[model samples]
Target: MKYSSILFAAALVFLAAGAAAAKVPAGLDRIEHIVVIYLENRSFDNLYALFPGADGPSARTRWAPQQDRTGKVYDLLPPVPDQRFPAALINAPFLIDQYVPQDAKTPDLVHRFYQNQLQINGGRNDRFAAWSDAGGLVMGFYDGRTTKLWAYAKKYTLADHFFQGAFGGSFLNHFWLVCACTPKYDDAPEAIRAKLDDQGQLISDGAITPDGFAVNTIQSRFQPHAASVTDEARLLPPVDLPTIGDSLSDKGISWAWYSGGWDDALAGKPAPSFQFHHQPFAYFSRYGDGSDERRLHLKDEAELYAAIAANRLPAVSFYKPLGIENQHPGYANITNGDNRAADLIDKIMQSRSWKSTLVIVTYDENGGFWDHVPPPKGDRWGPGTRVPALFISPFARKGYVDHTPYDTTSILKLIELRFKLKPLGSRDARAKAPLGALMLESK
Candidate 1:
């Protein structure tokens, strides 16, 4: 009895001591600045699955039966259909064989749909009859993968178990990432309201139409802007409901968003938010106001040093990339390993800003990739399907691989918790709380 009692006491002491040794991650400090650089779609393993045992607790998890079986749209197949891909290296059957996955390792319609994103990746392959393995595993035609992100993983913190909120495609998931909720599908106005039911839940369904908000409407708009301003014309309506932007602004902290230029066409994805950040960046460029709320812009990471050297660092700054760096498979740079996304993140870490700054790096969605987790929330869009979340700052614990399930709202939640600020909206306010492991008790 005495020995067991002694062991328990020792364990408690060790636990307390370990917690004392760890410091809070920089993002959760007074956390003056917050910058989220969302990359294109990708899951942790698909990108880092090859991380050579770098896979986390959830890596082994794969697709299987779930209540999600109700979402199958393949049953409504038409006799003839559009070409499966804008460009594919193999015939539909073979392409599906290579990419579209099946349950129990068999050949069937279900497997094909699961393999290449049938509904979300939309298209019919009734005509093209040829199988070519020129490209690689995924369709023979789409050949793009990069080594940059892996290199970045070597340098910074990588959150392996982070997840996307729910199922479906990028549209609703990205909306939730930004606003924490998709306002009743396609509610036209694209607004977020404050309301809670008995559940105190904020996430809603992806029902956009003339009656529901279509995926394109939410996914494309980059500017709270209009066509007259720059490229792709469709602008994301300005969100007044608080975001990480409002959180930092409230603390008299400075923040900036740096984006690679996109005129307008691609506003829905990473493009729109980049422009919104630039609106503030334009303010600092013209007025040269270096006080609180100073925002700036740059097309690439090359200019970051001068800005940091000039001591023009904002409390939080977001770096958006263009061209080869964005990591879109469409960019066709992946296999060749030109991870402009990974390198830019590495570059930011090399800066003096990294010391006190908490860099929140993640992707907008899985970008038609596959992950094993059945997302924990709504059926609309979600927690972007388990991409990696990297935290690189003085406060970040080295070699810390956390398995905590976090989503976009966790970003807002942590900031609000750290600063004693109000939650951004219903989803974040009511969603499950973020793991407090990143935080250290203030002295």
Candidate 2:
């Protein structure tokens, strides 16, 4: 059965019409394909406050709601307690050791790992530089459904509201986006030391065990990418549950991943490429076919830019840049990496395949940025974090801003519904379908 499935998929690719990639097929469940464009940091108030244009469902682009119905802006009482404004708290398991604000660079896990810790070297840490004064580190970012890349809001849709699922660092947020699940949200240490890929190689077994791989079964596959690089790995759940790639295969849909560098395929946690889900680690192991047929691993990040114009795009696509450009703490420039990422999405939008697809733009987490709305922890889909989310489609409502609460899981839920595939598990089956607001009635 699996062999026939493979043959069926190959047949579809051979016969897929080039020009047909631009239109959403009739009776296609919901969105036929989705592209998740997750960014680094920043929130809704910071980006949209100065953005002079059409916004929100109400068609107003005014600053935050710290105002009265009578045009009076009021300061929040008991004011939002955010560390990014005045000072951040140094929690335990942070900064290794703390030195009272010295002019020397030492190992500080709190400053590097904690999102709320805004200890910049050689300088002043302005709230505007880290986040906006309107809302503290928790303020979710709102995106212009239009003009993400010089495009018009009337032409696309903006999330206007989104938040991360966790309170710590980048690794956990990135993990959630991929798996729709994770066991350790912020349980791992800041300065993680691993027997696997942290500085070595990962060990794996077929079971979905938490520590990534069973220590006993971790034999050297000898292939450079064979094992993981982190021993501090957390187990991701619902293993048998279908991933997005699994659904694409069931529908005979094709997909591709163009990653940044050596660890571009999301390996090396406790290290740089910490964001990806755990499954990819086992997907193309040298223990299998030993052929790099499934994904495109690039040492050069620029190589992916050209695929934006390719006509035979897989039904689903995910791209993550490499190194300092991806906004790692070691080389962060605080320029709002999303601005550059937004530019990339803009480039992809002008392609020949814009009309038939949906692109979800959001952040993995706040990167210690702020949003006033505390993350909602409903019995199911979330307690989701708040970050700005953007939904872009040709059929998307112009100047629309959905007030509905959404998070990373909403994206997966939308895809599962639209594709008519089985949900990933309990999390997706019952999670709210926020994407329903983005689709046109005719669609």
Candidate 3:
């Protein structure tokens, strides 16, 4: 058959399958509120490798071997450097479950955009240690048995095949979660542009090398507070990107991005633990500091708690925890973050809106952790690595594991479908909604 005919056949098969799978469960329309609680940096295998029924790492599973910059496999993984820990004390790809206590912290690895591509290495997935600043620690895994969220997975719907929308750290993936598009800076100052080497890695000194990928971390030019002086170049300038919020508002639907420490951070308070880049809406002109949109939609996480108590939750909500509550390596540990998230869930369950709400719990990125499964083919930004996602609702299928191919944009797709809103006209336009086999009642 001609190539065009083959494509047409595939399209037909896809449409038929979708029609078969798409079921508007009874009472789905009664779900008036959708809450998305986005956590920080963890791969699915890193957190849910032993999840009861999810596709996670196993002893029988073939491990992706670590590769060196020279394309040679490491006989033994190297210790993460630039830390107080002795080189001999640490080894790459070690069972973190054995060493790090459930409450103890681990070193943060490099999960930057370019470095992740190097680690992915055209899907060989063997260069994690070679390209990461945290060395073999990049290959670490955890015991899900000790985590609270793991228990929650057994109670709700866990999606094992979900991936991060973009191939980068919290900064970019957060953008993908809210906007389903990468933030761009036109005419960026030469001083702040990522300097790259011939190998497409960011050069030691921050300049764009010829024909090299600008994958290194750069500072945002437009930070929330001018007094903050750390990693200024890492910030991206404010862009008028279209976001899910924009879409909802355009249709007169109510929504909010409730971020931890947002109010304190905007006030320039010290140690609010607010990450500027993590707040994607702040970068958009529509939600600038003094705008009515900012006041109405960009809210503190406390507001969400209050809304839950008052039974005034909006049609859509996205909640981001503060640094200490976010389950990020190096600065924070898994146990505390898991417990915090569980507490939030417990509160939601007790709230008045629980019966009419659908809660989605997921991470922003893999946080430089290793996973055995490769992400599906996607556009330039990503479908980076597998991350755990949970669908929690009164109507959600109990004790279920969803294997649908989804990414961060999938959340946006769900919101679009739920609100009958137009697409964001990016990857979200084509992203699959995680609605299959999740609801209790079927057509």
Best by lDDT: 3
Worst 10 residues of 1 by lDDT: 104-113
Candidate ranking (TM-score, best to worst): 3, 1, 2
Q: Quick one: RMSD of model 3? A: 5.8
Candidate 2 per-residue C-alpha lDDT over 353-428 given as tens digits, one digit per residue, 9 for 90 to 100: 6667677666555544333444554422233335566677765666676667666666666665665555544444
- For each candidate, the alpha-carbon lDDT, in order, equals 0.43, 0.42, 0.75
lDDT of 1 by residue, 1-443 (tens): 00113322443354344321123344456445555676655556456654533552242543331112234332222221224323333221122323422111211111111222222222221111111111212212121123545544555456776775433344444445544544333234434222223443323322232233333323223223344545332323333333455555656665555556543412334443343322322212121223333323322344454566665666656665653444444443343223555555556566666555666777655544444443444323434356767775555545556556677677756655655655545446545444432443341
Off by over 4 Å in 3: 1-27, 82-93, 197-223, 230-235, 440-443
**Which is the better candidate, 2 or 3, if ranked by TM-score?**
3
Best model per TM-score: 3
Per-model TM against the reference = 0.58, 0.57, 0.87
Q: Relative to the unseen true structure, what is the Cα RMSD of model 2?
A: 13.2
The digit string of per-residue lDDT tens for model 3 on 137-202 reads 877788777577777778878998999998878877877887776555545557755555555455
Model 2 residue 267 CA deviation in Å: 13
Better candidate by lDDT, 1 or 2: 1
Total clashes in model 2, counting residue pairs 3 or more apart in sequence or in different chains:
42
